[model samples]
Target: MLKSNIKTLIVIVGPTAIGKTALAIDIAKHYKTEIVSADSRQFFKEMEIGTAKPNAVELAAAKHHFINSHSVTQLFSTGDFEVEALKVIENIFEKHDQAVMVGGSGLYVNAVVNGLDEMPEIDLKIRAALNKQFDDEGLEIIQNQLKQHDPEYYEKVDQNNPQRMIRGLEVFLSTRKKLSSMLSSTKKQRPFNIIKIGLNTDRAKLYQSINLRVDKMMENGLLEEVKSLINYRRDNALNTVGYSELFDYLDEQVPLDVAVASIKQNTRRFAKRQLTWFRRDEDIKWFEPGKPESVINMIDQELKKP
Candidate 1:
């Protein structure tokens, strides 16, 4: 049994389509606590089908925070999320001793678990120039530049994300320092105890799941949803895998079938990247997605520590 005075934050993390959401809900219901979403893609109100957000049934099962809480036009950085999520967790703690946080966005998850690093002040003009370059020369130009300047970060970052590529380039241009070098390894201490759980499976099975998910999204009108957001195609939020590929189809840059194939391919690559990021954190305990009882038992054991 958990102590009455102890407060714990159960962090659920894994690759996309790996059952993080279902497991998170189970844990939240078991602990009788609310959920704090760390998924950056699910924060936008306009993005629905493509983001694979929790359905009505899941949301009804447990109270959730930060889902559909921001607009695509809003500039909600990781630092902004860190501040807001901590407040949400604090609020949940007022009513219950535990809160659940879950997402596949490694950066956002890390922001809440370990505070963001202090970045050097970047010149507004530098960012403007980068954005102008992206508009005129295309993301390829900016991506190649970022790759040349900061190859370490280039390897890990989602190459499809223009905003991320631009940020890395702008930091190097403004400070003459690689963004990867500036990222400190220090983790900030949080007031509440944190138990991190990771879900994963064999690569072949995971890829099959991702492909099936993309097909399901198409069946659920992901193309129509992407069409509705075409006017905002340039927005950073729409530059993601599913939306971007469809945008390419609308632009006559690729066939619909080709676009769908790209989405699956990119999503599989994204899952690989998520694994790379989370594996670096030695605190996380891994489990197969099929075994929830083991995860709960492990969490119960960890809660008894110290």
Candidate 2:
């Protein structure tokens, strides 16, 4: 590749609780560039403590996009993210030769680095009806509906999350096709060069990090934040690990201690899933989170690749 034509998107990816935010800041500061967060959960303005969003200091350390950029009440999908992120990258590239994208959300990263297939627009009434059914009946009804409609997606989706179940059911209903099918069509090529860096550690260490992070989130008033968002619990953005567990406790479905334990355990599980998804991307060079300089050097080398 010619040096004059270099426009790189350095994608930092890894499991939750693996210190991705700090590493991304370091790299962006080194490159004198900005950051685009691909963590789907952090996109909502109403979510903070539960999404493990970057602290005030971190946000100030580097210019960031997509954090607190949307309302939890709004419908923001992966396809939407691809569109917005491309626009962000285009504007960023107009000034800098490189930009950093960091998050544990593999699909969101893929959407930006690759692209998204065309997803059919579901009728508003369909989602409205599904929401009503989920409210009146229960997640079980929606769960069964998804299983019956798109068994493939239902098998992989978080069955406890009504948002995922409803999404799968609505896609199937709207296009008469499986959401999984739509996602697996093909990867779209992007104009700029992409270099992916993955951070990970031993399982025990990763789990330890997850546990400690959950404990820290609890100490940081995660319970209170969840309680405050109780009215938005049914919103798609709140149907995630940390917030969902606390919401369960708020509803008397579990004790506080049990809910805390659930948050830690579910976070570990989520980290494991994130690693599995990222492992499939052979382009992502793995690195220890502590070795930022090495990771940066690797990016420098990859960008220099002929």
Candidate 3:
């Protein structure tokens, strides 16, 4: 039985195209609560189709926060999200004893659940120099530097994401401290109880789902959507899987078929990275995507704990 006085945050995490949004909606409806999205990609208003945001029906099924909350032109960092999401959760707690948080972005989720460590203030000049180096020397140069300086973060970071690579580099250059080493080892306590549920399936099945989802995105006019955002192609938000591949296609770097195939391949690899990150969090209880009842029972079990 759920205690009336105990508030719970049900965190739904998993790889892309693994039915997290659907499960989260059902859970939110069951608890008579709202969902707070931690998916960084879905936060941008311009990134609808490619990000696989909740459809109109799903959004209507339950209230959601942070989906399409920011414009791609704005720089919404993890720290910003941490502050905003906490406020959103606190607001939800005022009305309901349980709230749902769902997303696949590991760092953003970690920021909310574990709290980000205080980062050393980076020098603007240092940041400018790094950006210039990226423009002149290219992503490979910065990626190599990060690998040499912070191998641990290098292994986990999205290597294709120059922004993340530059962040790791700038932190090291500014403070002489490795970015990975600066991550908080200690978990922060939240006022509400947290019930983390991870959704996953067998490897082959998950890969197949990712591939199919990419095909669905293509059919849903992802190419047209990417073309609409061509003006913002250089933006950090577009430096992601779906948009980047289509941008390459537009630049004549690859054929359309090849670009679509690359999206599938890259998405599969991304799912693997997501699983790796979530696996480290022993607090999360794993379940198949089809099993929401089991998840709810587990949430109930956790809520009843003293």
Q: Write the per-residue lDDT of candidate 2 for residues 113-158, one digit (tens) a residue.
A: 7677777899889999999999899888999989998886675545
Whole-model Cα lDDT of every candidate shown, in order: 0.91, 0.86, 0.91
Output the lDDT of residue 103, model 1.
Answer: 95
Q: Give the TM-score of candidate 3.
A: 0.96
Stretches of candidate 2 off by over 4 Å are 1-4, 120-129, 144-160, 173-176
- For every model shown, the clashing-pair count is 0, 0, 0
Model 3: per-residue Cα lDDT over 1-306, one tens digit each = 233566888999999999999999989988899999999899999999999999999999999999999999999999999999999999999999899999999999999999999889998899999999988987889999999999978766677787899999999999988998877677788887788899999999999999999999999999999999999987899899998899999999999999999999988898888998899888888999988888888877777777
Name the weakest run of 10 consecutive residues (lDDT summed) in model 1: 1-10
Off by over 4 Å in 1: 1-5
